[model samples]
Target: MLAIGMDLGGTAVKAVVIDHYGNVLKTMSKPLGQHATSIDEWNWKGVVKSVAADLMEEFKGRITAMGMSAPGICNEENTAIYSMPGRFYGLEKFIWTEYLDHETWILNDAHSALMAEAQFGAAKGYKHAILLTLGTGVGGGIIIDGKLLQGRNMMAGHLGHITVDADNPELDIFKIPGSIEDHIGNATIEKRTYNRYEATHELEAAYRAGDPVATYVWLSSVRKLSIAMCSLINALSPEVFVLGGGIAQAGDSLMKPLAAFMEIHEWRPRGEGVPVVVAHHGEHAGAIGAAAFAIRQSTK
Candidate 1:
């Protein structure tokens, strides 16, 4: 009936307590003190301990299950992170179950974000759905017939890595050029601009003002994203797409262009369009999904 979730971000650890009905009863976040650099297992465990202890201290016995929203690929049992960029160093060697009393189910942040959107935010009734969070990187997940789809390795949902171009300069974690994340990731934008804007807002502002350079960069990113979406359209044909993360905060600035580009590229035989919507959940989404996922998994 109750569960706790943790969103283990590169910079912060977000945790939440939620009921079976998808209501967030309580939440909190603790700073992990770094970005992109992995903290050692001992310190990482301490941070997790602090987050779990703080939430459990308040909700105490009210919690029923626990889960984690991690940054990258997870193992079959979801107990250890097998591989990731900026992974928690030594996490594969360290074990949480040894120190914690609760069993946990861990999912990639992208997958967890998708679950959160599906369970508590957007795409509620859609049987087939996809989520793309455009932030420091592009993250995505897919749902089919009302179930989270996972492959044999439980790492099948790396939608960001799907190739959009063959000759582009940008590259993904696998060193593939022109991947969706390589083109649209926040880091990619930064690399293109050469640190001219400290925040995505400045670049967005430039684009809004019709600055040619910014417009080109932004629209190009959108086009590549559209290509990726169209591929998904032709292959999986998901009913809806939920876009979240920081850059998606640009709202209509993103959706307007994204919609237009997708229209031209996607296969619309019957003229039916897949609605692209913004994520409604705030920062608590990943944490909420982790908790909800744990609860859902326990029932099975």
Candidate 2:
């Protein structure tokens, strides 16, 4: 069977057509024009509708099952976004099923990324795993005992908001002080570096060139990330931790140091270590995962 998966992002809307075997038959992305800074100008509802319509038409309306990944809490029914504040106006309680004229399954983007990795990417065969998307901020999901843990509110996999430091007073959006997101998320780069660097990529470039300050900042972030992972290892004991997102594009610059730190911090009882690998699906993970998720749901 074939299905459609769509990821609604801040800047663009990505969609894919895929079969049950996880082969992507077609992929397309639509820019959401310029991002609106305020709620009044947040124009996304119409664009998403158009994108969905266009995709359906292109496939001659044969593709029926659809799934969406968005940046918010998805309802238990997976019909609409449950709650999302400060962006994507009209997304809250906006029913994709009603708008798209199809029964659409919706999931949080981070959770969707995990689903993609768990379904066909890094953690394909693993029954238990963790996925972390390290970009503008840290977002994560958990798969436990061969199932995605979508807590009571469908909010279980929020790994980024966990506290890493008690002494630090800085709070993230969730009001958690010194959380992992504050330490390693790209959103915190300027604040963490005292405005020395504006983005993680620039810091990584400087770190590569042997710049002392950049090296310090970059490694510090990775060290905190490793620390968080070690704590998670003790708590969840996932078989593997898959890393994704834009900052993860640093390749060995991020992985090698992270490995070193994990070796130092992670406690292994039998000397067995959990592997931390990069995500296989890359940028299209959300969309692909959404499609895969829809296909799975359809089969069920």
Candidate 3:
């Protein structure tokens, strides 16, 4: 049987068809048709309806399930989104089942990325894993004993918003102070650098060119990020860490120092520092993972 997976991103919606073996067969995409900061619920519903109809018509009886990866805290029962509205603000308590006619699942986008990587990418073959996607915001997920850690309210792994610096004044919506995302998200990085670079890579390039200002700024953020990782390593001790998203695309420019700091700093009660690797799937990870989640849940 096939499964339909959708990654409902702020800028666009990516959909994919995957077979039982975790292979993505066909893919579809469209603009999310909403503002970056907010969404019109009625317009979003219409967009989803049209997209679901297209997938259903093409797959028909062969499709066994449909799943969506969305931003926010998904309810434990998978019936609706309850909080943390990054883009789909009006979707709180919005029932997702009404959008389709199949076995369905709704997942936090970061969790979906973890599912995809655990099954087919960086975290494959590991029982305990951690994934951090660093982009406009920092996203995270935890895998324990081969299962995604979805807690009572399904907000258990919202790692990015974790407060590491209580005195940090960068407010995330006017209240949160010193959260990880506010300190190191790509958006924050650009702002912190005074818009000197448009993307993280530019900043990395400047740092590599031995630019003193770039070196200081980049290292400072990396140090904060390493501190956060050390906490997770000490607490969870995952077997591996997969770093995805635009910022991670900087590759060793990002990993080398982080690894160096982590090796010296991360708790080693179990042994040495865990392997931190780049993600195998990129933008399509959410859709692929959404399919994998449904496929796994169906069998269980």
Candidate 4:
């Protein structure tokens, strides 16, 4: 029936009410208020309560279950956040379920995105799939045999941390170079284009004009992304790879080169040509996935 979904982002929080079919009946968003540099348990609980209260007030009894997509490693039960490397300061100690009704389900935001794709978007019919979202950072989700793979410690599908380059490493929390995120994230695109403050339109225009710098930058990003995809293809052999998030709007400009690279690098001869498709749901995938999770939890 109906469910409530919340996507807790670094800068903003998005909440939505959806039916079992993944239709958004109503939605709301708000800027994340002042958060401690280290997000303590109290602060984390407070934030969830405040946001949930706002949505619950409107939907009221219509909500059957609730799901939250946050940016860290969620506990196996999906009741608490175990770790969030750089962004969520004091989250390690927070038990999210304590802040909500016991019926709520919590999951990694990336996982939620993948669930959305698997349930209603690009990976709808695929038995195995991977969802990669390129935005402020690279986030990913993995599904095998039509089920989400929550590896040991519930951190299996963190595709962004996978190292693409060992020799020229991109140093991050894990000290790995050329992390998937480092190579293809929006921040990297902004840096490469030399338009840190320019909008996506300007960068797209530059690419259209055949600017050498922009071309090189764009291709470089695509190459890095393709390498990561090829690795995933070799490892998981998913039937489809769904790319979403802001940069994915580049369409063929990004997909064409990625396709070529995947063809060249993928190890599996039979599945070398796995389709790389854009997510139909776009930014709404997270919300939809959250809703789906909520529905599933309620049914249980």
Candidate 5:
């Protein structure tokens, strides 16, 4: 069966058509523009309408279902937003499902990423796993016994918002001080390194060149990430930890320090031999996961 997947991000909305086995057939993307202030800002209904029209026009009679992944807290019914940080606002009551006029499943963007990893990527065959996306903000999802953990109200997997420091909290526009996002996310890394350099690529190159300032900034971010990972490992003992997103592209630079820090801090049994791997699908993971969800929902 063919399904449509939509990944709504801060700056872009990506859509894809995929088959039941996770193979992408076609893809499309559109810039969300600056109007996408918060999770509610994008004429969400309009976007969905446009995407549906596009897919229907392209595939004619092939597509069977649709699924969406957004960067926010999605309600248990998979219809509306509970809370969103970067893009879209005042959307607590807005329901995207109603606008679609088709069977649709909405999930937190991180949950979709984790689902992608669990179903087809690094976490495949693992019953319990944590997928972390180190991007503009740190996003995470937890999977247990092959099921996504959507707590009461479907707000269970906001690992990025977990408090790291009770006393000296790192503040961000979201106002959630001490949030894990504030510690190791892309913005944090950028701000920490900007005084020494202006561009992200430059900072990365500096890190590669062994610049002390860049190393300090990068290592500091990785250390915070390691702490968060260790906490998750202790709590869930996931079989695999899959890391993805723009920052994850740092590859060994990001994973090595994180692994070393986890080694020193994590508890014995949970930490031992735990595999930390990079995401295989890259940015398309959300789309793939959404497609997978759509296919599963159709079968059900």
Candidate 6:
């Protein structure tokens, strides 16, 4: 049988149809309708339903299960997002099963990305791993002892919001001081570089051009990320670390400096440093992961 995985992003909804083996058979994406001036004006609920209907019609009897991934903390029931302020209008606590007329599983987007990696991507075959998605903001997840760590409040793997510099005045979305996101996330690139760079790519380009300011800013961010990874390594002790999202696309520009810094900061007991790699599923990670989650849950 096949499974449906849907990723509800800020601008679009991405869905994938995959077989039991996790091979993708079809993919769909649609914009999230007109922009809403306020939460009450949002139209994403309809958009999501429409997308699901279209996919369901196409796959028909072949589809067996479905899962959704979105930007928020999933409730313990895995039925809906319990907390996601300032976006997606009616998403919070909206029951997917009742609306979609099917048994649907849901998870946080970051957790879904890590799930994709653990099931079929970078962290496949590893019992313990961590994933960090560095984009406009940093998102994270962890797998421990072969299971995703949802914690008591399902907020276990918010690695980016963890404080790396407690004395710094800046706080992240979670109001944590000097969070790793504040240091390296794309949202703070301009502020961190004194308005000289608008995005991480621009900074990386300037750094490649031997610009002193760009070099300083980029390396500093990478260093903070390394420190964060080191802290996670010590705490969770995952066998591997996977990096994904837009920022990880910097290739050697990001990985090289991160490697150099990790060499200095990461703790290596018995000379066994944790392996760090880029995600294998790329942009489709959330969709693939949602499908994987659905397939497994349905079988169980």
> Using Cα atoms with residue i matched to residue i, what is each candidate's TM-score against the true structure?
0.93, 0.96, 0.92, 0.88, 0.89, 0.97
The sequence of per-residue lDDT tens digits that candidate 2 reaches over residues 86-169 is 878778998888878888899899999999999989999999999889999899999999888899989888899998897787
For TM-score, the strongest prediction is: 6
Local distance difference test values of all predictions, in order: 0.82, 0.88, 0.83, 0.77, 0.79, 0.90
Ranking by lDDT: 6, 2, 3, 1, 5, 4
Against the hidden true structure, what lDDT does model 2 obtain? 0.88
Give residue 265's error in model 4 in angstroms: 2.8
Task: For residues 1-300, write the lDDT of model 4, one tens digit per residue.
Answer: 788788887767787788888777887776666655754532655666777887788877777788888888888888767888667776664665665754678888889888888887889989999988888778889989988998999988878888877777348566778797877776665665676425454565576678887777767777888888888888888899999888888877777777887777777665448888988875557767877876776776
The residue-level lDDT of candidate 1 at 203 comes to 85
Best by lDDT: 6
**What are the per-residue Cα lDDT tens digits for candidate 5 across 1-300?**
888988877667788898877878898887766774554555655666697779878998888988888777787677766777444765565676677777788778888888888888899899999988888778888889988898886878777877677565556554667777876766665567766765445677788899999878778778888888888888998888888888888877777778789889888753366788998887778977887877776787
Better of 3 and 5 by TM-score: 3
lDDT of 1 at 110: 84
Candidate 1 structure quality by residue, lDDT tens digits, 244-291: 898889977888998899879988889788888899887888888888
Candidate 3: pairs in clash? none
Q: Write the per-residue lDDT of candidate 3 for residues 1-300, one digit (tens) a residue.
A: 788888888777888999987888888888866474445443665676677789889887788877888888888777667785455666788877765655678888999999899988999999999998899889899999998998987877778877778887666753668877877787777677887877777888999999988898898788888888888878898989888888888877888889887877788875767888999998989988988888888877
Candidate 6 lDDT score relative to the true structure: 0.90
Assess the local accuracy of residue 196 in candidate 4 as a C-alpha lDDT between 0 and 100: 42
Error of 4 at 216 (Å): 1.2
Q: On lDDT, who's better, 1 or 2?
A: 2
